[model samples]
Target chain A: MSAPTEIAIHHVDAGRMGFFTDTTVCIGCKACEVACKQWNDLPADGSQFTRGGSYDHTGELSAATWRHVRFVEIAENGGHLPQLPAGNEVDVDAAVAAMENWVFMSDVCKHCTNAGCLDACPTGALIRTEFDTVVLQPDVCNGCGYCVPACPFGVVDRDPRDGRAAKCTLCYDRLQDGLEPACAKACPTDSIQFGPYEELVRTAERRVSELRRRGIEGAYLYGAGDATGEQLAGGLGAFFLLTEPPERYGLPARAESPVQENVVPATAAAVAAGVLAAAGATAAFALARGRR
Target chain B: MSERDATPALGTRGEPASWARAGADVALQRTRWGDAAWSFLFGRDTGYAAAEAQPGEVAEANRRMRSGPLPDPVEGPFVKAPVWTWEVPLYFWFGGVAAGSSFVGLACDAAGDGRSAAVARKVALAAVLPCPPLLIVDLGRPARFLNMLRIFKPRSPMNTGAWALVAFSALGAGAVAADVAGRPRMARAAGAANAAIGGYLGSYTGILLAATAVPVWARSRLFLGPIFVSTATASGAAACRLALVAAGVPAGHPTRTALGNLETGAMLCELGLAQLNQRRLGRAARPLHEGRAGRLFRAAEWMVGAGLALRLVRRPLGPRVHHLASTLYLAGGLAFRYAWIEAGKASARDDEAVALMGRGAVTRGDALRRPGEARRLASAARRPRHNGRVGAAYAETVRRVSLVVERALRP
Candidate 1:
């Protein structure tokens, strides 16, 4: 007996996992934020609250905070806001009047196909899950921090407290339990959706087309069809459907794999270092013999 | 339970109250996350029942913390993996062994001491032994060791290295085998083979580094080759004396001093080469003098200096001092390898090294242009159209070289 090329659609494991984020529908309620924290049992972003920034403060994605809701207050009248302006040093009323759009996005680890952190990790602490998602094993991490700088998107981070690596698991536990991620479940406006990977892709595609029809031409899916594109076929496991170019959300336009450029120079340097050391020792011995 | 289910959850069952308190405290810490509904629902202790768990919970936590996360995350972009870190160290090991063995061989040959020759052979074999381990360590998948032989690309220094290493190993083994065989003719042939192979291997390691994208290694290729060659010569001498000692050869031998002088000369050259290379490269040399690499480099320099001092007082120290000197030289050589690895990595990591090397390269190119301009001016009288023209006109005249040459010769 051979495996069936065409199986009944119902019999297939078509429950591909994915994520749906509706930035427009998001009210910055942060209910998903609290749910993620409670479920994951993560620590606070920091000891102090950052006041200078706009509505949402958690700053950036780090070991502590997995989900970050960025609050960008769009002003009109070609003016700036009193505290958080869309532009720097402009009139508030004018900016508010001139404001064409107000935007908010919740950022998370992309689970990139070509994860730099995974590639740079010396201890094999980083790996890919069956779901094709990037996952980290903290226990094996040597805290070398090579993965920290290797990341193109700056997603993975080291916890200063434990000196071990930490990041979102895409709720691996919840995922294993046959439930949606806590954040997605807790989202009030269905802003976060989790399901089969394929379904999510189709849904995202349809959503983009619908948005474009509605004159939201800026709507775009980041890391959806591959953010770095075919240049790096290493597709992202945790991709995003964005309403703007990825750069606006701090995503790299073109991230090159470091492994491609590093092998040669690194090998050569190692050889030189080794040879010089041997020669130095040999020379020292010769000097000693000369005295005798 | 299946083997997977038999394994407990990553977070071990602990004192529920403490766990709950820990969660509660965390909640109190964050105002936005810790509202009344969350506080009411989870409570101060939540449902954590840590007290029921066994003492093994601690160990379990440690284990889970280590292995549970399985794979780490990809955070940023544009950072290359640390292939260099492992690669540089292996290079150090190979180069060190090669140079050390060669030094012993050179000294033994110069002394014409049979015991010294035997010692040199042993040292060479010993030096080569660490190479496989170093190479394996640098590879991500050590099990696929045979892949190193999959290609014979000339552009790849590593490919060339495999061959160099093979020749060196064979020659070294032959030399040692002949010495052990106690045959005069065989010993002489082995000695010659060792000398020729050792010289090529010693210098080629430097060229290997220089041929890469590594700015520091590439810029100092010429000097690096010579330095390693000379260092090998000194190490070979040291190994020769050490061998004689092991064989209990008589002390106060004149040949010992000659080997010592040879070593001293090599040390002086190494020191001069290091200084010159650094001066020429400037900021690119920072790695050689800083951090772990810097410490190792300084230690090597100190060892070489002290070894030189020992040479000056060998008469006072007597024959026993040769052993100590050989040991120092050996230690210093390893230190240099470690330092060089660390320094090269640093040079590659830091922007300054690349900038300095690039500037040096550009300057060298600029310098070459001046000589060409001067030559053009000297030959201007023969080509009137090209006379005094430097950039475009000089090129055009060169392009019409046959006509100009014929016109000048016709007169």
Candidate 2:
């Protein structure tokens, strides 16, 4: 792959851009999903059928389906749903009016600060755009598919037909023209809001505080890491504010970076291998003396 | 996007009906997400729910991990179905043998055993010279293989490995050439460099597997590297000793005895570390105990045990016994490498293991259930499988301790 800086030499800096996803207000209208397909010119990924139980069933993020909306409906004892809104009080009657009482969050590529797919792509086909979000240079990808499993979030995949890797670009083409991502643009409630990265984080934090202040206990902003700790992919460029645990929204409870997970074990294994080889060499003398 | 491509019309990725076919994926398109509303009242993976959540009916559990119906409809996430196939593992075995033989050559040189050193060097060259070609074959084409050298990203091990292979091969060629040209000093220096690289060459393949997110490989990270090196050196010892015996090295030669002892020690470490890794991994180790992988693992264990027994009487053992043990040791080494790979595929195929890499104790029943059984009977061990996995672990520890005692007090 060509050098990122040299590749972007003609294009001036656009500053950092990202998505501020508030899953709280999402209506799951799927307008963003449809719009992304149309803009990207991607084919439908076989999700038009009734998938038994869930509404908004595009399944998951794949090579084709860049933006996915996940629906989770939790009900306790009776038929009453867990629509315990900001007040923390569950009412059977109010939940009935809440679109079958399912929490809807539109999911997309996290575009992590430390993107594993980018790091793992041997061909350098995955590179950081001027806006700092990761994009796939499909023409340069050699179809190695290393980025597929390398993704901690499993957002990338090899297109079976072309034998090349594909994923969301955060609409890199749109960003060049000072336009927002298609999913964000088509979002009816502005749940998938796109803006400057820093501004989005600040506003997302304030939104979290607002939601929590209103009595939503689980209202936390995911992928907005500061100096304190690193969260999903060391804080995603595309992050979210959710009213439930990450797992409840089809996210990892602890979305660890592949680097952290790999380094510790790799070091230990390397050390052990080196030590065992040395020990075996020394033990040979002792064992031979006994044999004689 | 080519108009001719027309979306590729890829089918759902499911297990193929013809099990013998390799890498052919069929479409059973499924969405992994579903509402956890009234479905909570029913058991999971049992049946599909026709009804949606009742009006306002709050559900208890709605974890997206639990959203998919059980007995997974799609093939579990294998990512790339292990990019390095038969050629890679075979290359690993050959490269390891070369590395191990280099150590033998070094040892024989130090001990002033020129005949043994000569054979070892020849063996090392013979084994290693084929690696790059095997690796290229695995990569599908020489051009694609060259693509690996397109970058020097140490952050990516694949990048480092490509560069390392080039260096290792060049150094190995230089050593063999010097050895043949009767330039002992140049051969010595080249051999030393080759040996140093061999340390990495012999074991980096295992590290490559461990560095991946695959649960079985990831969990065995601490042991895989060591295990690879052990097998490499042990089998190298066997191959070198057999070559010397064929070259008419005297029956009572100290070099032969020492090599035999070295082989036993390495194999013992391999046996102990292998079981320890598998047991520590618990549910993740399931792949090592079932199917073709399991058979291969068992064969490797048996061969190691036989080789160890042969080592006990190696000083008095006839040339025929030495040859038999040598064959077994080499076979065992190959078995271990191949089995480790097959186990990786098995580990990836299991949906439950893929999903549940626990931070702590999960369920005991997950560990206890044998392969392909849907009915999970949760006993005292539960899903996290504390005691069941430990059953194999205890036996291994006992066998290892006895072998250590027997070898240590042999004189």
Candidate 3:
């Protein structure tokens, strides 16, 4: 029989911050990936970029990418890609063997409180649950691409395979049953943790302190703790713990939403269009009359 | 502006009756400022004393998140929950039909083309047929779409639009029927009717969106009307070109050329207005010029530009080119609508946009404090706050006006 893998899982409300990823502790095994997919019933995206430089082929989060373990491999001495440690040859095998510094972080959708995707959805496809997590209703989506740009994080996307909008539902159905999300369930390292939003924030803070005490002072939560409304995109529903800055993982430094400003110009253009159209119609009539 | 125009005579014996005149007259007459003080208490749509606040009003609920602890539901910024979905169909149907019908009447009137007039009348009636479907299909409860007619509220664009649509539909139908009966005299009257109803049909859509609390639509209310007019004209011209070809008129018919000229001019107007829109909108406008919708709008605009150039050069590209150009212009207009809707929703989704609008409201409140303006805002503000449902329903009314403007101005 297989040994039971213990990973921490918690339930949280929508607004409280959570997550502090300690990349230094990660082994890049992608146990989190298997757990999320196996539990979520997510179809496997075939690995093509796998086996290259300690990297996992799962590059991002999608409806399928509920959890993706990113692998960033450094030289034995910790340097750039395509270059070998001073003692080793540059072949793929040697590179993998010589690689001593590898940072693995599992990423997922940040259930944002000020979710622009949910706000922009004309058909109410995107909704926030009582848990404060943002989820998508596939049936209600009209496939209007408004949410694509409205999302500051570029998390929500249209399934080109299907026309409807798609994003992680944060395992909403499971949470309702008083269970943790699938991704957290399968994490072998206790790295991808889940819990109440407030408790998670506190846990993440304590975890950061613990790591800092252990001499890994660089550990920090990305969208979690101090990521306020001004600094983040409406505050992430699922905040992250990270050792490096958010931008290193492709998050924007600051976010802005344009919905309010657009009404003024849109209204003005509409008004001008109305007046000009009337004038033009009148002119057309005059010209026709002149010809007569 | 011309002496000969004489304010374009609201109703002439030779002209068809317009519903807009009734609406405009109602609006002008119901100006509470000029009427007795009691009028404010009983001011039709503007009057809130009789109506109960919607159920959602007791709880400050935005379908989207509301920041900084929900305010007292009874406090200012109280909104009636949006009763209807902001249906995309309404945008298309109302604007398309209005533009198509208005063009038919106007073109036939201009050319003295008897067959064209008959076709125009038929098309005009057909245009009005879509309004009910548009309104009903987009409603949360399609059955309630008809309740809009109960009160003739001047401040409520939806009420005005409902009355206008009904009036326009009757006149449009009568005009067509007269033409079908070979009543040239009545046909002339229908043309006049079309003229009167048609003028405001296109402009009302702009007014509708402008009156909303939706910051994107409210801020640019002034220009949206003109843009709608321009696009509608371009579309009307395109529709006319199609009708002409269907009628077996040769590609180079004088009427076709004239329609082409109108379309070209309108396309130019739309482009110029969009440029102006870019300047006024700041970052929100980025979605209009970038990404898929932007690409489509730009391509359509380019096609119109090329078509305009071809028409100007007088190369006589034959029916195919003209037809292609006409379709291109129509496509461009639709793209513009798509872009506008996308941009508006995008703007609404942002917390910052709300904050910015919130701050702008503060400054606006400050500005209103001067002289008599503050009193009006305060009074206007005193009008019962709507829940999100009511706001949505109200938005539909404004959308109706926007739709009309889009149709009326089609080329």
List ranges where model 1 is wrong by over 4 Å.
A1-292, B1-95, B103-115, B352-411
Worst-scoring 10-residue span by lDDT in model 2 chain A:
A1-10
Per-prediction DockQ comes to 0.04, 0.09, 0.04
Ranked candidates (TM-score, high to low) = 2, 3, 1
* Residues A102-150 of candidate 3: C-alpha lDDT, one tens digit per residue: 6666766776654555545444446556566677754344344446545
Tens digits of per-residue lDDT, candidate 2, B113-198, equal: 66677777778887888887887655422233445555555556556666767787787778778878888878777766766677
Error of 3 at B348 (Å): 20
lDDT for each residue of candidate 2 in A100-192, tens digit (9 for 90 to 100): 457788888988766777667665567777777788864345555567656766678776654556789998876654456778767766677
Scored by Cα lDDT, where does model 1 land? 0.52
Per-residue lDDT tens digits for candidate 3, residues B93-191, read 345546644765665566676666666567666656776676655543233344445334444344566677778788887877787787978877866
DockQ, model 1, C-alpha based: 0.04
Best candidate according to TM-score: 2
Which model, 1 or 2, shows the larger DockQ? 2
CA error at residue B348 for candidate 2, angstroms = 5.0
